[model samples]
Target: MSEIVAVDAEPLDLPLSEPFEIALGTRREASNVLVTVETADGTRGHGEGSPLPPVTGETRTAALETVRAATELLEGEPVEEYRRLTALVRDAFPGMVSATFALETAVLDTYCREREIPLSALFGGPPTTVETDLTVPILPPAEAGERAATAVERGYNRLKLKLGTDVSTDVERVAAVLDAVPNVGLKIDANQGWTPKETVRFADRLADENVRLELIEQPVPASDVTGLADVTRRVDVPIAADEAVFAPQDAVRIVHENAADIINVKPSKSGLLGAADIVSIARGADLELMIGCMLESAVGIHASAHLVAGSGAFRYVDLDGNRLLASDVVPTDDGPGHEIGGPGHGVTPDR
Candidate 1:
């Protein structure tokens, strides 16, 4: 029996120099849930989860409390296998999904380190680097235009723009971005802030703008699966389900209902393992997949990137969390450091 070790959770404030705004919310500060699990052998592993109110109904305070609850169960539980470790926590804290994920990732990291096996090899395939789409926050039309130009200059070929606060404002913002960055591929995320009618109308407008809208994510609320399917049928741009596809069962429904053309997978909302299952389910249906990240550190970004690289299902990726941060801990290695690299999960924060 592996003796239950130490579990600790703390809060950190990572400031984003630029304000990130979308229809669902806005933020200048990023709150991180940092978790560490230690084994009897004195080996310690670190994992991170960002409490995103827009996606998961978890705040920093709540996440910490849940972390505390989860850590209590680590004292003597076996950590040799991911499933056994995950089951121990799930049975204890039945519904605190993000907290469970935070604890699980830390435990998994420790287990992988013990076996000296890279996380990418354990789960998916060999580690491969991927290109990420840079996100452009909602701003005034002129500022959005300038930001778009700046992103293109910085070597980003794909862009994601925040939309759905206002129809006219969203349109003008997209127009400004397109006019400024002519060859860049564009995608918009409404964060489920529009009505079905509004989503349909805006999608038509985007198609008319000659912008080559890659995919519009969660135009309607998460619960409105019917409305989402309607928008998918009405729009020329493919619809991506973000808020709507959180659980494994949600993936099955979307495929059955024809609600989306692409699914955006974020581990914090669905947990690392749960998100992987969702990707497999989507692949079974022949749906395109995009791996996305919240405003997190390279630690969290690297975990998701490992899964993306292993699965070979990612068509578009948005692992640009490092660029949004004030600093990165890991130095540039021969691998895809900015996109993804290193051993298991490749997350070495600049501590």
Candidate 2:
């Protein structure tokens, strides 16, 4: 029956090369969890989940516990029923979106290995390459500028800087980055750290100062759809919804409210199927899409990258998960973008 014979999970602390700061909190390391699944015939696979307590409100401990419980529900299940099995894990733990994605990724990896197919084919499209924007966390203008310029030197044309602490300093941060690299593509994510008025003022000030942004993301708190819409209507740049969309219904609600022009889709926000639903909803609503990632490792980043590569539905890609990690196994830097080859998520840590 191609049944699962073993399921296990563990916690890991991925140390960051530098400190990460945002509107919500600061972290020196990413707290993550890993899940491993084995089939009756010795086929095995692994998945990783990264939880940002400040963003998703999911701590690593909680994610680890959820994954442990999910493994109980997954053992003895058929690998061929991967979709159904993932759905069961997702339904059994409604709030554990990141955890369920880990389970789904692990299950799908195992299934693909068993069938000798590519997990990159999960979204029904051929594999593709994506250029990602490395993120500079909220820091002093000079530090932010240095990081942005460094990313540019490493062949990244686009850079995303975290703002929303103070509008004045935030503008200075942008200016510093521009000073470092005049023509680099820039995007800002406030992480729901400001009000609607503050958002409008910030965007207008940037426009007045000749600084251009590709998009302004989630300036207000997640649930404030009215405020989000107000900012979107007021700002010259495109407004993107990030934390505001945690599920398919959340995306539909934001669409109905006209809250955002672009919707940021993260696999950690929903299970794989749910994220796909949101992507379809965005397409149906004529909203632009940006595929995002949490502070994930290669295990999780590779899985999400496969989805992004296979879907090819995004206008923007921010898949640099916790970039300054002490050990990022994938060879993402020193290149314009990342590519996946071979089968079953195609993640090799040769770098």
Candidate 3:
């Protein structure tokens, strides 16, 4: 039996090629925590977690401390007892979702590597290439259009625009991008920055202006599910819930209330196990699934991509976090892109 011999985690800060602006804030760098688990048989498994203070209420310092504490609880355990080990880690760090994700991923990676199998193979799905949408950060209308055009030129057909600053200005930004790349599929993420009324107003204005939106995500605040339902009722565009749903219970409530047409699943926000549960709940409710990320490194993004490919549940993929990074832990054949091969999330950290 394979046994976990050691656990290690470290803080990783990678500079972004350009400032990533969104409704929440602007980030010039990606701050992530990398976790690794080593087995007695000399196999190593890697994982990554990024703590978004605004979204998960976890800062780097807190994440580091929580990860260290959780790893201490996992050392010397048999790799086969992953469920019990993960349950112990979750119980120890109840609110540290990112930390939990890092630990759980390491465990799973180690297990899969020991078996000489890909992570997707465990789910009985053949690994396949997944196309992802590049995000256009909130910018001046013209600048947004230029960026959109550039993304389309680079073989990305789908674009996600960050909105939610102001209704009129948001419309202008969308209009500018559409004017530049007329045929590109478009989706907008408000990041829970708009009120229900404001969300409806934006949708109406976009419709009036003849803008075709693939979807509008998290228009209203996360705490206001009723408000989300209100906006959903008013908008013809599909509404996806990101901040509003973090756990399976949240997924259940969103479906029960019919608050959203889709659920955005982030493994960092919910651990791999939790994400799987959320996927099951979403499929059961006949809700569309989207796999997203939180400004993570190639490690986290690649792991998330495997989840997206393995489940075959997600209709949308927003794994562009690595595109913002100046350097990547997992080097690609091409510079940086959404590609995972080999086994166990594919690549090893250069360090």
Candidate 4:
């Protein structure tokens, strides 16, 4: 095994297929950062960061700056020590977040390629395939219903609708989707757009409509844990904590307070190692796990898919971020997931 020589990062603008909106904001394009790790033996591996500033509280400039400083700390480190290297990145740049894992993913990719094993093997699991749920951003009810139908036409049975603007309008929007396509697995994410009362009211409305939702995600504000618990206990539908659980400590708190029934693990919120911690905490507390994405490119999506596929712990998956991109830095199948059979992440950047 050779020593790591250089770490490089650059911001890449990947255009979206269309405007993607949620309660937090809208994204016409993905603000992604790519990281490249080079070893002394001429091995190169790549990783990507897709930060939703509104959700993860990380900006493109901050991620790039973190990578620059990280390069100084990582150069000359042994590539075989990839796990320790990733934890070092987390310790040095705790605020960098998603970028921390981007570097770690690159290092792990290099290590896996050197060993000629897929990332699933690194996580101690055989290669497996995972299904993903498509998304419909905030839109009018009729339009939302049409989008749901189109997704079903494309062979996806699960759909997540981004809502939270108005309760009545939201109810109508979901009802419209049901009217258009009734038997699909329907999940709504409010992105912290509603109050606890509103969430309960909306759930009751959906119940009256005889809608059996797979789950409701982060309807109330992230800070409102008491309210989140209230809504979770009051509603018949299970509630998943997205923004509410950013770190393992947050997951522990949610467990102690009985705030949520499921925890959403968005890689962009915490890096690979941090994600593992959160997963362990969730499992210990008997909480279900959901793997989500933040509208990243194929590079980022590949890493998350490999992690989820390797672990086989998540009950629900929403890794359709790469599918939202018109193009990506990494080459991959024109779909939402990865076939975790090849070495490392089995990904290479076009650039």
Q: In model 2, how large is the Cα lDDT of residue 73?
A: 85
lDDT of 4 by residue, 1-351 (tens): 999998999988889988998999888998888999999988888888877677767898999888988998889999998778887888888767768868988888888888888877765576677678899999999999998898888778889999999999999999899888899988999999999999999999989877899999999999999999999999999999999987788889999999999999977777766787888899999999998888787677777788787787889999898877887665555443455465788788887
Local accuracy of candidate 3 as per-residue lDDT tens digits, 100-189: 888888888888788777777755576677678999999999999999998888888999999989999999999999999999999999
Query: What clash count does candidate 1 reach?
Result: 3
lDDT of 1 at 310: 76
Tell me each candidate's TM-score.
0.93, 0.96, 0.97, 0.96
What global local distance difference test value does model 3 have? 0.86
- Candidate 1 lands at a TM-score of 0.93
lDDT of 2 by residue, 1-351 (tens): 499999888876789888889899888888887778899999887777888776677878888889887777888889989878977887788877778878888888888878877777878766667678899999999999998888888888998899998899999999999999889988999999999999999988988987789999899999789999999998989999999998999999999999999999988887677788998999999999998888887777777777787887888989888466888756555454667654677663332
Q: How far out, in Å, is residue 35 in model 2?
A: 0.6
Worst 10 residues of 1 by lDDT: 332-341
lDDT of 4 at 45: 85
Better of 2 and 4 by TM-score: 4
What residue pairs clash in candidate 4, if any at all? none
If both were scored by lDDT, which would come out higher, candidate 2 or candidate 4? 4
Cα-based lDDT at residue 246, candidate 4 = 75
Candidate 2 weakest lDDT stretch, 10 residues: 342-351
lDDT of 2: 0.84
lDDT (Cα atoms) of all candidates against the true structure: 0.79, 0.84, 0.86, 0.85
Off by over 4 Å in 3: 333-337
